[model samples]
Target: MTTILVTGGTGTLGRLVTERLRADGHEVRVLSRHTQPYAVDLREGGPGLDAALDGVETVVHCASSPRGDEQAADHLIAAARRAGVGHLVYISIVGVDRVPFGYYRSKLAVERRIEESGLRWTVLRATQFHDLVVTMLQKLAKPPVVLVPAGVSDQPVEVAEVADRLAELALAAPAGRVPDMGGPHVRTFDSLARAYLRATGRRRRVLGMPLFGKTYRAFRAGGHLAPEQAVGKGTFEEYLARRFGQ
Candidate 1:
C-alpha cells in the first residue's frame, strides 16, 4: 500500500480525496491548518509539514487559498522533495491559464512551480464544482432580482467524481497535466439560475446583466468550459436533486 498525504484535508475536495484514498487501502495522512491528525500551515512552511511528509510516497495537493496558493505550493514542494516523495498530484481549476481572474492566475503560478519542482508530478484541472455554483446562486437569490453575467457559461462537475479521479492518479505514475475533467452539460448562467430557482421552489426574477472587463470577456469566450473533455457522469440537475432533496 502506498503512503499518501492529502493537503487541504478538511475542505470539500480534499475530504473526499482523503476518503477515496483510504478506501483504496492506501495509508492516508490529512494535512490541514485548523485542526487535524497533522496540523500544518501551508503558507508557513513549518516543521509540521516536514513531519507529515516523512515516508510519504505520494502527495495529492488539494489545499489552495486565493491569496497564498503559490506560497503553499512552494512549501509543499520543498518538503516533498526533501522527503523524496514518489509522486505529487495537484488539483487545479480548468481555464486557470485562460481565465484572467486573479485566483486563476494564482493557480497557474502554482502549476508552474509543481512542473519545475523536479519531482514526478501530475496536474489535473477540473471545472468548478456543483456545490460552488449552487452556493453562488443562493447568495444572489437574496437580492430582489438575481443578476447574472451575460454570455457566460458554466460547466460544473460533481465533487465525488473529481475525488475518484484524483485517487486514480495518486496510484499511477505521474503524467504531466492530464486531460481536463468537466461536467456532462454546459449551460448558460441564466439557465443555471433558473433551474436552481425551480429546484428550490423560489420565484425570483433573473436578470442577465452586461458585464464589462477582460475577465467577463474571457468567461464569455468559454474559458471555463471543456466540452470536448466533458467526462463526468453526474449532471447539474442530479446534483441539485441529491443536495436539496428536490
Candidate 2:
C-alpha cells in the first residue's frame, strides 16, 4: 500500500478525496492548520510538515487560499521534492487562466508552479461544485428577489465526483494537464436560481442584474464551462433534491 498525503483534507473536495484514498486501503495523512492528528500548515513551514511527508509516495494537493496560494504551493512542492514524493496530483478549477477573478488567477499561478516543479505531477481542472453554486444562490436569495448576474452560466459538478477522479489519478502514473471535468448540464444563473426557489418551496423572483468589468464578462462568456469535457454525471436538480430532499 502507498502512503499518501492530502492537503486541505478538511474542506469539501479535499475531505472526499481523503476518504476515497483511505477506503482504498492506502495509508493517508491529512494536513491542516490546527493541532489535529496530522496538523501541518503550509504557510508556517513547521517541522510537522517534514514528518507528514516522510514516506509519502504521493500527494493529492487540494489546499487553496486565494491570498497565499502561490507561497503555499511553492512550499509544498519544495517539501515534496525534498521528501522524494513520487507523484503530486493537483486539483484546479476550469478556466482559471481565462477567468479574471483574483482567486482564479491565484489558482492558475499555482498550476504553473506545479507543472514546473520538476517532479511527476497531474493537474485536473474541474468546474465549480454543486454545493458552491447552491450556496451562492442561497446567499443571494433575499426577501423579494434573488439577484443574479445576467448571461452567466454554471456547470457545477459534484464534489464527490471530482474527489473520485482525483483518487484515481493519484494511483495512476502522472499525466500532465488531464481533461477537464464539468457537470452534465450547463444552466444560466437565472434558471438555477429559479430551480433552487422551486425546490425549496420559495417564490422569490430572480432578478438578472447586469454586472460590469472583466470578471462578469468572462463569466458571461462561459469561462468556467467545459462543454466538450462534461464528464460528471450529477445534475443540479439531483444535487438540490439530495441536499433539501425536494
Candidate 3:
C-alpha cells in the first residue's frame, strides 16, 4: 500500500480527501504544525517534511488558507519539491485564469510551479462549496438587507464531490489541469439567499446591488461558472433539504 500525506487534514475539503484515501487502504498521514503520527508544516521546510514523506507515493496538497494565492503556495511547492514527494495533487478553484482575484492568481502561480517541476502532478479545479454558501448566509443575516452582487452567479458544488475527484486523481495519472467540477444548478445570489432563507425558515429580505471591483466584475461575467466542464450530481435544493431536514 502506498503512503499518502495530506497537508490540510483537519479542514472541510482536506478531511474528506484524507478520509477517502484512508478508506481506500492507503497508509494516510496528516501534515500539520501540530505533531502527531506524522506532521509537517509548510511555512518551515526541511527534514521534517522528508521524515513525514518517507515512503509516501503521493502528496495531496489540501492544506491552504481561504486566500491561497501564489505567494503562499510558493512555500508549499518548495517544501514538496524538497521532500521529493512523488505525485503532487493540488486542489484549486475554478476560473482562476479568468478571474482577477488575488487568491486565484496565487493558485495559478502554484499550478505553474508544478507544471515546471518535472514532477507528476494533477490540478483539480472546482467551483465554490456549501461552506461558502453557509458563510454568506451568516454574513448577510441582517433583516431587510442581504446585500449581494446584482447579476453575479454561482454553481456551488459539494466539497465531498471535490474530495472524491481528488482521490480519483491520486489513483490515476496526473491529468494536468483536469475538468471543472460544479454544482447541479446555475444560480444567482438572490436565488441562493432565498433558498437559504426558506431552508432555515428565516424571514430576511434580500437587497440586490451592483457588483463592484475587478473581482465582482469578473464574477458577473460568468467567469466562475464552467458549463462546458461542469460535472456534479448535487443540486442546491438537495443541499438545502439535507441541511434543513425538510
Candidate 4:
C-alpha cells in the first residue's frame, strides 16, 4: 500500500479525501495546523512538516486559506522535495487563470509553482462548492432584501465528488492538469439565493445589483464556468433538501 500524506486533512474536502484513501487501504497521514503527531503550520513552515512527509509517496494538498497559500505551497514543495515525495496533487478552482480575483490569482500562482517544482505533479480545477455558495447566500440574505450581483452565475459542485476524484488521482500516475469538473447546472446567483431562502424557510426579496468592476464583469462573462465539463450530478435543490430536510 502506498503511504500518502494529505495536507489540510481535517477540512471539508480534505477530510473526505483522507477517508477515501484510507478506505482504499492506503497508509494515510493527516496533516493540519492542530492535528496531533502531524500538526504543522504550512504557512509559517512549522516544525513537524518534515516528520509528516516521512515515507510519504504522494501528497494531496488541500490546505488553503484566503491568503498565504503561496507561502504554504512553497514550504510544502520544499519539504516534499527534501523528503523525495514522488507525486504532488493539488486542488484548484476552475477559473483561477481566467478570474482576476486575489484568491484566484494566488491559486494560479500555486498551480504554476507545482508545475515547475521539478516533481511529478497533477492539478485538478473544480467549480465552486455547494457549501461556499450557501455561505454567500447566507451573507446576502442577512439584509431584508438580498442583493446579488447581476448577470453573475455559479456552478456549484459536490465536495464529496471532488474528494473522490482527488483520491482516484492520488492512486494513479501524475497526469498534469486533468479535465475540469463542474456542477450539473449553471444557475444565476439570484436563483441559488432563492433556493437557499426556500430551504431555510426564510422569506426575503431577492434583487440583482449591477456592481461595476472587472471582477464582476468577469463573473458575468462566465469566466469561472465549465459548461463543457458538467460532470457533477448533484443539484442545488438536492443539496438543500439533504442538508435542511424536506
Q: After superposition, how far is residue 125 of candidate 4 from its true place, in Å?
A: 0.2
Q: How much is the lDDT of residue 245 in candidate 1? A: 92
Q: How much RMSD separates candidate 4 from the native structure?
A: 0.7
**TM-score for each model:** 0.98, 0.97, 0.92, 0.99
**Model 2, span 1-246: residue lDDT tens:** 999999999999889999999999999989988747778879777678888899999999998875888988988988998999999999999999888999999999999999999999999999999999888888898668788998898898989999999999999999999999999888898999998998899988788889899998999999989999888998999999999999
Lowest-lDDT window of 10 residues in candidate 1?
32-41
lDDT tens digits, residues 1-246, model 1? 999999998899999999998898889999999866689889998988989999999999999886898999999999999999989999999999999999999999999999999999999999999999999999989987999998899999999999999999999999999999999989999999999998999999999999899999999999989999999999999999998899
Per-residue lDDT of model 4, residues 71-190, tens digit only: 999999999999999999999999998889999999999999999999999999999999999988888899999999988999999999999999999999999999999999999999
**Model 4 TM-score on a 0 to 1 scale:** 0.99
Q: How many residue pairs clash (N, CA or C atoms closer than 3 angstroms) in each of the candidate models, in the order given? A: 0, 0, 2, 0
lDDT of 3 by residue, 1-246 (tens): 878888888888888998998899998888876757656557555567667777777888887764534544566566667767778999888898999988788777778987887788999889999778878877887656788779978998988889998988998877788878888778898889888888888888787888569898899998988877668888877888997886
Minimum summed lDDT over a 10-residue window in model 2 is located at 35-44
**Candidate 3 lDDT:** 0.81
- Considering lDDT, where higher is better, how would the candidates rank from best to worst? 4, 1, 2, 3
What's model 2's lDDT at 114? Answer: 91
Off by over 4 Å in 4: none
Q: How close is each model in CA RMSD to the real structure?
A: 0.8, 1.0, 1.8, 0.7
Q: Of the pair 3 and 4, which is ahead by lDDT? A: 4
Better of 2 and 3 by lDDT: 2
Clash pairs for candidate 4 = none
Model 1 ranges off by over 4 Å: none
192 in model 1: Cα distance from truth in Å? Answer: 0.5
**lDDT (Cα atoms) of all candidates against the true structure:** 0.94, 0.91, 0.81, 0.95
